[model samples]
Target: MGALFDHLIAVPILLPLLAGALMVIVDDRRRPFKIAVNLVSTLTLLIVAITLLMIAGGMTASGDPARTSVYLLGNWPAPFAITLVLDRLSALMLVLTSVLAVAALIFSLARWHRAGPHFHTLFQFLLVGINGAFLTGDLFNLFVFFEVMLAASYGLVLHGSGTARVRAGLHYIAINLSASLLFLIGVALIYGVTGTLNMADLAARVGDASAENRVILEAGAAILGIAFLVKSGMWPLGFWLPTAYTAAAAPVAAIFAIMSKVGVYVVLRLSLLVFGPEAGDSAGFGAHWILVGGMVTIGFGMIGVLASQGLSRIAGYSVLVSSGTLLAVIGYGTAPVISGALYYLVSSTLTISAFFLLIELVERARDAGADVLAVTMEAFGEDEAEDAEEEVGVTIPFTLAVLGASFAGIALLLAGLPPLSGFLAKFAMIHGMFNPTGLGDGLPIGAGTWVLVALLIVSGLAALIAMTRSGISIFWASIERTVPSVRVIEVLPVLGLLGLCLAMTLQGGAVIRYMDETAASLSEPAGYIESVLTAERVARAPSGTPDPAQGADEETEVAP
Candidate 1:
């Protein structure tokens, strides 16, 4: 049973991998097989959720102490082998990813069946890569998982490949491929200097390196950071995001909601581990740069959102804004701030994914062709039609009303209004910035305080104004044509995602606590290193060279 728990580390990745392969093999005509695959995905998600709950419970029970779990592939040791590791942070992320994956799958069932053969296969493979990326503990393995996810995403993104989608997909592929190359080069450099690719091991060793070696490590880390930044849709590097995300199919774009987070996850993990306070004076270097870059990203995204005319593009810019804010919080480098950032990460990802889903629904309903005015007209027509049909009152579907209300709520939350998860998350971060602790007071008293204050005010205002504009355009304006019916597939995902955002808002405390624990674990890298090395060693059995077991073990360890 204990050994089986170790296997739990790999289940999230393996289930999807096997499911994808099976999906490819199963005839499309075999409805049962497809149903089984869906069942498998749902069950896999349930397992991941249960596992995370158990882990979170354990962490809470232990008084929030750092805990680690190791899964050794083929029963070999690490360094000479590979391993899988899970901690608070990775567990939380895994659960989040699983939830989103299930939602995405459910959303796709109706529409994606019409897409083509092996659509499910591509989706499952993408999940495999995503789950693998979240769990793995090695640097090189991270790149591998990234490639896997990117490859899967390429197919998914270009699935329908209308002219616009194809063009966007090409741009997405080109940029990400370039980023991947940079990632590889950075990894090679880091390996050259540190002689180790294990993240935890690297963290332990990086602090001890000579000054010159530290310089090399920082340079490598910077390059790696750039790769992640591009993925996260940070300023300058993220021009490809809006078009790519906007042009993707609804369900495909929904999956992409998890995509940007992968970059944020890497940035959060690497920054906390590789450049933590323990890295001594060198730690501050990357932190300052991230902070500056994040601020710039926020400004850029804000301008884009305010100026954008299309709903999809607006949503895309919103993603950039959310990413920028989270990154900025991370740049602050305090435990409280990180906790806040983590909370915001959860809220933002859920909310934005929901937002995107809603945008798709609205677009479909209005036959709006992604135009802002068209969406507005549909909403208005629906409202007017309801008024006209029933002298007493036309009964709008409670689901539709709830969806609209939820979008409005999310807008409020994004604006940092009180009594919402977004506000709480931002408040927590602001609190951390002003009152520094273990994460350090990275900013100056007068200047930093003012800057943060300005950001808070500006961000809140920007969100408010943008939402107001979008809301008026979507809900109040008149439509020139009859609204189209929304497909069940699209509606289900949007509702599910919106429900999640609402739940997060209601359960902010629990979410914050989970994030706090996760951040703490990330700040302390010893347990992660031990688990990965332990698993790797158990898997390899002194193989003297990298092999399949080593690869598998490494893959498992990199999940978080």
Candidate 2:
């Protein structure tokens, strides 16, 4: 059981990979079989992910020596072999991805999956990419996984055939292709300079790298940062995000809410672990750029949300704002602030994802032509008489009630309103910002700090106003009200995501504590480094027949 359990960490990446390939071999017409495979694969992943999350959080059934676990592929040694590491951060991301994958897959079964062939296969491949990215312990594998994810996303983004989808998908593909090439260049430069692609190894050497090597590494990092920035949707580099997300199928868009965060995750991991204060002369490199860019991104997103007429675009901008907030908090360089931002990351992601799923349903009844006019009228307070066709009814229907309630919940969550996890996350961050203890000497809360606070408040205010206006137009100012055909499948996924946000709110204390610990673990990567650097101690066998090892008195201690 011990040896077998130790190997389970590989399942998250492999299960999805094999399932996707198998599903691809299954004929596209075999809908039932494909759906079954997709469902089973995702469910299994969910269970495994939850178990791994517990193990990573130090709640394993038995031994829990360290919070980081490393799984070597093909029984290879560390630094010279492929490795997948499970720490609090990676495990949290895996669980989050699995949860979203399950919900989105279920929701797709309602109708979206039928839009085109191989939807299940693409989704599974996307998971393979995402899970691999999270668990991989090396820079080369990270690039590999990133490409896999992006490739799957290109197909998913264009799943539903339409001019808008095609256009957005093309632009997305082009931009990401450029980014991928640059990503390769950066990886090459780093590998050439450092002589090792293992992330732990890089972190160990980068701090003490020779002056020439440091210059080359920084150049590579600059190119790498552009790829990440493009993914994170930071201001100018991101204008494509809203378009692509809005054009995608709802479930695809919902899953894509986390796609942007992949860049955020990488940035956070590399910045703190490799280029931290421990990096000597190169310490805190690019931190200022990240801080400034994030601020600008937030301002950009706020404006987009306010200016946009469509609910999808609004949700898309909300994603941008979420990314900006997390990035900015990361730049603040405080553990408590990072913890709060982690909370915000979860809360905002769940909320925006739910909102994306709900938007299509909410808009199903509207005049297809009205989408543009709706945005136009909502953005500019057009002084026009209420339409003669506008019909008002005192009676409320089930679907309308559901949509209204969901919209209100999204507003509260995204706007950081009181009595929600969003508000709590922001509060914690502000508190941490004002009090950055243990910076050797005290660093004053400067203008940027105040700007961040003000931005948080103003952005919340902006989201509130935008949501209210859109809600009124969508729910109240309906000229032609059609009770949307709401499927149980569609609603359940959205509810599940929102419910998770609610759960975070309900258990804010425990969740934040977990995040604080996560931030602490991220701040100090020694556990992760040791697990990845050391040979995983496995049970040794005798020269003859292998039985639980001849003289083994104690179970071989390995990373949990």
Candidate 3:
């Protein structure tokens, strides 16, 4: 029974792969069938993700609370074959990806799915890449998954076939293609230096390299890190993000939120595992650069938030803000800080995704170019005061009211206001920064720490102001605009995402505990290395012998 559960880790990747292939064969005219296939596959992925997470976090009897699970392909040994690793961090990311995918897929079914022929197929393939990237334990396979993910996203971005989407998609594609090239070069160099591309093997061998080899290894890792940081939407490299995200379909944009985090995740995982304290001379390499880069990115993202006019652009910049915060805390090199950052990561992701969907619905009520006209009027003083009429009460329509309420909720979450998960996440992060070592350790809070805290507060303030202005423009000043015919299908996904945020708030204690445990395991890499390097292949019975576990006349392998 336990042995059967061990294979669940592979299902997240394989199910999507097979489902996508099936989707490709189905006739494009049969939209309903394709949607059903995609829906079932995604929901199943979600269940599998949650179950894997339980196993990773040791919530079940079959799982070990302190161990990492490594699955070798073809029952091959480590450093010689492809591998998939399931630990607290990877499992958490899988769950996150699945949840966002389900929401985005359902949202697409409303109308976005009809904009292109292969929408369902591309969506499933995107999941294949994302889940594979999270689960794969080898550098080469990571690159493979990244390309698969990017290729599918390129199609999704161009799904609607508009001039804006085309232009933005081209630019996005060009930038990522260059990043992919860099990724391959780095992988090649790392393999050349270490004779292995497996992450666990690299971690075990990196510190033992000769002096010249260590320099090459470090260079390769730096090149690799650049590829990830670009994807992470760091300031300079991320110049294309706002335009690309603003032009994407709302559902596409919502899912793209997680795309940036893929870079952040790799950076986080590799930074700790490959260059951690155990890595002799390379211990803590590049920490300062990541720290400084993150601070600058935060300030840049905050400024972009303040300067942007459109809601989609604001949401795009918010992604940068979230990434910057996570990067800074990860570079801070403390377990407690990372724990808080993990919580913040999840909260911000949910908030940004919900905000994206809400933006599409809200904009439906206004005429095109309304935002530009409003800005122009505000700037040129073209507005004339109306005569004071009899004071009359105005009743808001139900759809508009729901939108306003959802918008307000998103605002609270983004601004880190009280009674929601956002505030708790930020508070926890700040608290961690203040007490770096723990309470009463008497360590002085560094100047850098203060800067991060201030940035967090100011960024939240910026978000509040921007969202408030946008909401008023859409809902209040434009009262004469026709109420959009928002379907229940569209609105429910938005509300469902917000409800998840609220649930996070209500269950804050348990969530924080899980994050804390994840952080602890991440900070200590010894266990992860031991598990991956020492994982054993299943022992097989003699040929033609019926194994008791199989209860049939066939050879069976048993895990001992």
Judging by TM-score, tell me the better candidate of 1 and 3: 3
Candidates 1 and 2 compared: the better one by TM-score is 2
User: What TM-score does structure 3 among the candidates reach?
Assistant: 0.94
- TM-score for each prediction? 0.87, 0.93, 0.94
lDDT against the true structure, per candidate, is 0.74, 0.86, 0.87
Give candidate 1 misplaced runs (Cα > 4 Å): 29-32, 56-66, 367-400, 438-444, 481-484, 487-489, 530-560
Q: Which pairs of residues clash in candidate 2, taking residues 3 or more apart in a chain or in different chains?
A: 309-375
Tens digits of per-residue lDDT for model 2 on 1-560? 25776889999999999999999888899999999999999999999999888778875456544457888775556676688988888888998899889988998999999998789999999999999998999988999999999999999999978999999999999999999999999998888888888888788778878998899999998888889889999878999999999999999999998899899999999888878767788878888888888888999999999988888989989999999998888777778788888888888888888998999899888887675777667568675566544444468898899889988999999899988888998998888788777322224789999999999989999999999988887888765677888998899898888889889899999998889888887777777777688756465545686543233333332221
Residues 1-560, model 1: lDDT tens digits: 26566567788788888888877878877866786776677666668656755764473344655357766555555653455667777777777777777777777676655575667788888887887888887888889899999999999998774799999999999999999999998898888788888777777677788888878878888899999999999888999998999998877887788789899888888888877767765665577777777888888888887777676777788788888887777777677778888888877777777777777666565544535544445447444566554445535455556556766876877787877777887888887777666453445556755686578668778878888776665554524323446666667766676677668878877777777766666666666666565543333345467555445544433221
Global CA lDDT of candidate 2, please? 0.86
Judging by lDDT against the true structure, name the best candidate. 3
Better candidate by TM-score, 2 or 3: 3
Ranking by TM-score: 3, 2, 1
